[model samples]
Target: MNQHFIRNIEVKKVRHHKNFSIHIDDTYPKHVIFTGKNGSGKTSLLEGVKSFLELFDQYSIPALSEWRDMVRYNEKSLNEADPSNVYLTDQFRNQITFFSDQIDQFCKKVELDIKNAHEIHHLLEEGKFLIAYFNATRTSSMLTPNGVEKVSLTKKYPIQRGAGDVFIKYLVDLKTQAMFARQEGDLDTANRLDEWFSYIEYNLKYIFENDDLTLHFDYKNYNFLILEPNKEPYDLTRLSSGFSSIFSILAELIMRMESSRTNLYDVEGIVIIDEIEAHLHVSLQKKIFKFLTDFFPKVQFIISTHSPFVLSSVNDAIIYDLYEKESYEDFSNYSYEAIVEDFLGVDQYSSIVKDNLTEYENLINKSSSLTQEEEEKVQKISTYLDNAPDAHSNELKLKKSYIDLKRILREDTI
Candidate 1:
């Protein structure tokens, strides 16, 4: 079995990040999450990893000049706004030359830290171990590329950014080729193609909790059809944006891995997804990480999301809260409200509820000097708030406020 995952990474001024580093130890879960607000280096971290690994190719470059797009907007002003090649300063030189020296330095460090550079690059090219980053370009449609018939063993290693709709294209090309093989009376070849695609199709059905769902290529209409157990079949285009977002990611990822590795079970490597909860429902957000980790058990998933529901899904997953600069390995016991409050700095309570809670807290502060009737009233309010039905799931946060007042009366402090 071929396996690879990042052990450590360090970078400076790679993108919007001035200094960034991460280390993955053996104790880390197969699934990891990086989460923060917009413009908080989540995307930059993924970009840095992609840049670092792609540089090891030594022969073919990885469109490194795109690093300019990954920088601080004002940093562009640091470059000569010169349209025609005349520029001064290290910043402008870095931009013009695609950060050549920094990339060279980073690649040298990678080669030193993770030796066997030749073997690593070769395995990556063969897709023995995959490393890919996915951003928000998934909703776009895919068109089959010319000359693409069936999966080719020596297919040129693809960089995903060049084609946003790789998954759909993979499906169209493979299924279309299978249909042609069947028409040509090549039963064995057709069956082989179907067999290759069915693994991912079956897993997709499972991930979606749609056991009776079926996928078909509509050659007549040139559409991919989704057939539920009882309903009439519909085009993939009819699916919701949330479905499109997640389905495209899963399809592209597995398809790319399969192009080199025929078995889904043996595929292993890193997959970084930005804004993992993009169009997902709250329930789907909670299940997405667990679903991916469970289905693709060997692959290391490093995902970013703004959803606290995602943060609370898996107990063993590593969550790097970039905004807080904190890492947590166990969070399943945390309440959704507490996760939101502590991780996102979001106040999950309504204004009226917040106002009332604050008032009760202030009243509790007077525990050192409370009249008998006033103390009784404060206790009643606190109890009511504590026992509120909606407060059940929020026991973690509720313990600090209204419930703690009960402790304050006995201990003379809140």
Candidate 2:
């Protein structure tokens, strides 16, 4: 496959911006991560890219009518006769031109043109160059049986409404495909399906370290079951939120990769995941990127995350911290603390704990002797630190800080 990357993208009057430009290809990382506070236009930027890709696939340009309706409100230019006219002369117009030229260049580079539209369509149908988008507002409610009903491959899959529905359907489809393959004496295809299932099981076990729990598919009922080491198997509905979330994401990704005739380790395509850290623990967030990179080495993952753990885990990814605008910042070498404070705009430790520590320090500085109130506050902080969960490495540093503060208090008393 020809190497294709979005060289640059510029937008104006899109949402909250007069002009915004991002040059991705110039500092091309293996993957890209979007991080920002809420209402920071991260999702808008992702949607813009998605729109461009879809329009390019259809050989269509951004229509002026669509822009007029979609463009950001011109609050400053209310006096203008037509606010939409401003878009035609500003960065929005330039962005349209840029997208058009880039799409043409990319098509030529990939040997896709008007004459090869049929070929492009075939490739897209086969899931080649797939652009998978996972919306943030996914629900983890029970996967209804109707959601897993056999879908015709001849038709496009329905847009997933529930969080786990798409994954459940994919799992059911795989089982169906495997059974059909076996009946047709296609052992290789059946075996591949089995292999994929085993891969999922292996990774789940590795991550969870629950040797007793194993993933099982019930061919009889077309349902997924979780089998304990010695206990009776349970339905997927009984699984924990974390397990369900992880399994759903991994299953969907594996299915997409397989559709393109790519193995777990060799899948190549673009995957856009909004709120990638949703429902994931810090430990899982740290491992998720590593696992994804190992599983889908060639895949271009564009993710929007709010977790410092996720940002810190990835070293070779381009991190775009979108606040007022989007800009590529190399966060591969940044420490977790730096990532939290600088990119995430927050302290590494809890604000409550930091405040207590600051107050304790202030009291200690004001007088050489420790008062009853100051001593009680220090003791309270020390107790809090002692009781705090050490799920993260930063917690250890916090614990040390508490110890040092106690030691200083002791010295002051002496």
Candidate 3:
């Protein structure tokens, strides 16, 4: 089923800096949602869809030049401050070098649009589609050039030459003695590297079978808890920075959906989730948008959110509202009704559902028991935020300020 479609996207001077453009309506409810705030430019519009998913290798080329140095930043004074100012352009300029020195040693010249830079780099190099930048390197850490501080991914493919570095060195030596018995801490080599990373995440992608594959992870106590009977390892910094940001966004969307499967929708990819309701838990941000609407329904998700439960159970998602445009070095001539009234006139979706329903009713009254259907769904969201009123309208004032932020998380658990 090898599919892909991203219709439109544009960003410039990158991070928080705008010369923005966004258009997507590739028909049907393919489901996509993105609201904004924390450094708007929502992950620099997911680094222009991971630089259009590294022009289709779907990830390779040092994982798209280490995700274009994570939403590009490096303008050694815009090439020594405007060295004849050509900057960077590709929309099919051909000599295709969209700027680098590993993104100029960390995010610099991220502004684009030179009169539609040769027709948006020839429609993102003819939409082989690729773009997925997320959580802007949350707490920035990545090391492994043998310095090994944390950036882990080298069973081999960081480069050893071809066949995807010989199948990542034969799957790290067929799971290198269970990935060094769980990185040498051992508990039966970390339960055989957590059951061979859950059998390469349930036998790598759909050769067919369907039940939409299932497994978003929370394996009740992890280090990779392969059926945690009592092994207790999950200390990726004591899980819960919203479960280590949903295990670093489900390990970068299951290794970019199991390295471009080569066919079934042959890696056309597009994922732009920024602040996708960060540090989630409005039921794991509604199970991360119902696991990206039924696990990558032919991938093409654009997200930037301030959350109205990630924009009311998104359908064919599209809503923009970025402001500021004094005199175009950029916020790209702002207009779309001043970007949806600068995010619904700073109501910002009722303060992102009153700060995620006060952290989802304080993680369900500090979870010890709940089952009677999460106590009648926290008593019908505490009787509709104690009988709504305060001039409610911005979607019922974000559903009664997320039901009085889940009744101040059940009054701080009484």
Candidate 4:
């Protein structure tokens, strides 16, 4: 297994960040999660890392330079007083040297002029590296029936619409090729397709926990189908948003690992996910970290999230809480409420309720007889607590005490 790690990252005058540095390696957790308020440069940092990785390849250096120029210019003042600066340190740059040999070897392969030849070669080329970036907005459409047949015959890979949709299109294309092979008595090619499909199915079932749901390649319509245990088959397009998000990411990862011929245990690469908790329910968010860690133990996952539930999901993860400066806080043992209050800057209890409780306490502790205004204030506080949203058990018990105090005050006044 080829291990790749960014020992440290330094960025200056990029996006909303001025100067920032992050350290990541074996000494730290393999999985790192970034949490911050919106516009705190979380996505910017991810993009910076992506660009840095691209620089490792000779073929991609020019593109990275061009991108830097564009970002620098756009971020500069009208007079161009400040320039955009972004680059990896020599230490981190040296780490990516290990992948260069594999990348060069893959790019040197002889070109094959066959149907879908470009797509196959492209997939193979990408397989040389394990690095992938998953965009938050993913598409779910598959190629139309006529379009699939045309591409299958022409052997041309279609332009990708989105990561998820493109992956499904690849599966459909492979299935079509298998059909063609079967008609021509090419059983070997057909058998290879079957094996790939079975691998995908097994992984999906194992990771997704949908034992009754089976994946099917709809060659006739050129769509992906999911057959439920006791329900009718449905198009992959109709899957729930949360399921679609997770499935698309998993499918892409599995496909990349398979294409690169990387073993499950030896797969080492960086995966950047923006808004990792988007569209996921609380239950799924809590379980997602464990699943990903167990599934890809060697892969380094960098994720940005806003969910407290997601924050509390992992104990060993390196957490970067971005504010004015990056703070590495230990939240491993913090409760959900503590995480929300301290890290997220949100109080577990409502301020209105707290204020009312305070007023009720002060009134009860009075040494002199209650005035008309104080009596009226207590009545309003009681009314407010009665209508307020459900609170903690301790708070509820306190409310009961306030009610008893109100009864005593009324009887004393009478």
What C-alpha lDDT values do all the predictions have? 0.64, 0.61, 0.44, 0.60
The candidate that wins on TM-score is 1
Better of 3 and 4 by TM-score: 4
Model 4 clash pairs are 115-155, 116-155, 116-156
- Tens digits of per-residue lDDT for model 3 on 1-414? 323455455555565555555554434324345454445555555555555444333222344455455434343323334344454422212222344443432334232212212232233344433344555334212111221122223211111011221222223333545556666677676685566555455632221123234333332221222222334433233444655554454444444434443423234445555666577666555446655555556665666666555554544455554433211112224432343345434542356445545544664646376678777766765555455442344554555567557656776876
- What is the descending lDDT order? 1, 2, 4, 3
User: Candidate 1: where is the Cα deviation over 4 Å?
Assistant: 14-20, 26-31, 37-39, 57-118, 144-158, 162-198, 229-232, 294-298, 359-390, 396-414
Tens digit per residue, CA lDDT, model 4, 241-355: 8777776677556555544443353455567787777788787887776777677776678788877888877776678876545555456577666677667666666777778
lDDT of 3: 0.44
lDDT of 1: 0.64
Candidate 3 displacement at residue 14 in angstroms: 11
- Could you list the CA RMSD of all candidates, in the order they appear? 8.4, 8.5, 19.8, 11.4
**Residue pairs in steric clash, candidate 2?**
none
Which residue pairs clash in candidate 1? Answer: none
lDDT of 2 at 402: 66
